[model samples]
Target: MNRSYEIMFIVRPDVEEADLDKLIEGLTGNIVSGGGEVKAAEKMGRRRLAYTVRKFNDGFYVLLHVLAEGGLITEIERRLRVQEQVIKFITVRMDEEEKRLAKVKALRDSKVKRSALPAVEAVAEAPAAAEPAAAV
Candidate 1:
């Protein structure tokens, strides 16, 4: 079965733009060749990292949205680990998160919309009702 995944990787900061493009193309090609669908491939550009990785302070960020089987994903990760330019990488399954969000949305939609008017009227009537009771 196919599942959605987000793959984010950080490449070495000193790598040239052209080389980065080629690397991304090659990886995407691998995905397609492996029978996985690339939903989105985004070069998020270079940015500073929170902490130093492989003794580098920053690197190019790449995010890929993919739909594929688990075996294909593991193979992709293995490829990334072997690649020289990739400094750090992580893959997350998005299907569970998507399902959770959808469930929350449906629950929110099904909830009863409570109005404040009735409660306000009850509070307002309480004082008048108490005054009459005291008089009686």
Candidate 2:
């Protein structure tokens, strides 16, 4: 059975971009070779850490969406643990309900629909005498 996961990892800021690329490439390769498929990945540029980690105050963040077997995920986590450059990481498994909700959210996020009523009308009905605002 295939399972979906959202993985986020933080790496030390001092690490070079090439090294970071190698780490991500290595892990993704491992996932595919171990029977998994990567869906989406986003690199959230380096930023200050909430609290110091390994005596550092900032780290680079990366997020990945992937589908894989259960056992492969365990190995992925294990590989992350042994890396000196990784400060912290998290993986969230999507259950049936969560997966359904994610699909709904994706659809909603991509839409471009305007409401029939203006903001004020939607919030509260005005007196019958009030005139509609002039169009821009």
Candidate 3:
């Protein structure tokens, strides 16, 4: 049976872009060998992490949407765990019901115009100050 997954991983901030591409190439090759088809792949770039991890404040993020056999996800995750460059990783299963809903959501999101977003001031009231600042 075919199944879908959303896999996300954070690589160490020190990795060069060329090495990162090589790593991605190796991983995708493994997935394809294991009978998986990559749907959407994205590099979300480096961003500040909520908290420090291994003394690093940022990580390079990558996300892959794939369709593959159910058992392949476990194999892929195991490989990731053994890789030193990967700081964190996760693979989430997407069932048929969720897939359908995701398709609908994607379609809806694509149709919305960025300029059509409502003005922030018109949407809510300003908050009052809770306490006055003390003089130095």
Candidate 4:
């Protein structure tokens, strides 16, 4: 079954920008060739690492959102493991998170709509009530 996933990876900071772009393209190419569809790809740029990794104090961060079969994820991870430029990488399945977020958003939207209607009705009634008080 196809599932939603988020992949975050840190590349060695010394890599050139052009090389970084090529690396990202190659990784995404692997996903596409494996029958996965990439939803979003973000390059978060160079950032300081929480701790040293492979003696590097900083790294380039990239995040990718994808939908793919379980097997494809394994393949992608395997490729990352063998890549020399990738200092660290992680993948998270987002199906449950997505469902929960959707539920929360829907509930919030409904509450907002309900709250808005009463405010407008109350404002409309206020002017009418003031007119009667003035006549009295």
Poorly placed runs, candidate 4 (over 4 Å): 122-136
User: Per-residue lDDT tens digits of candidate 1, residues 1-136?
Assistant: 9999999999999999999999999999999999999999999999999999999999999999999999999999999999999999999999999999999777554432222334466777555545543453
Report backbone clashes per prediction. 0, 0, 0, 0
Model 3 agreement with the true structure over 47-76: per-residue lDDT tens digits: 888888778889999999988887888888
- Cα error of candidate 3 at position 15, Å: 0.5
The collision pairs in model 1 are: none
Which predicted model would earn the best lDDT? 4
Could you tell me every candidate's TM-score relative to the true structure?
Answer: 0.79, 0.72, 0.71, 0.84
Candidate 4 is scored at a TM of 0.84
Across residues 9-89, which tens digit of lDDT does each residue of candidate 4 receive?
Answer: 999998999999999899899999989999999999999999999999999999999999999999999999999999999
Native-to-model Cα distance after best TM-score fit, residue 35 in candidate 4, in Å:
0.5
Using TM-score as the measure, the top candidate is 4
> Sorted on lDDT, highest at the top, how do the candidates line up?
4, 1, 2, 3
Candidate 1's C-alpha lDDT?
0.89
Ranking by TM-score: 4, 1, 2, 3
Q: Would you give me the overall lDDT of model 2?
A: 0.83
Candidate 4 lDDT score relative to the true structure = 0.90
Query: Lowest summed-lDDT stretch of 10 residues in model 1?
Result: 110-119
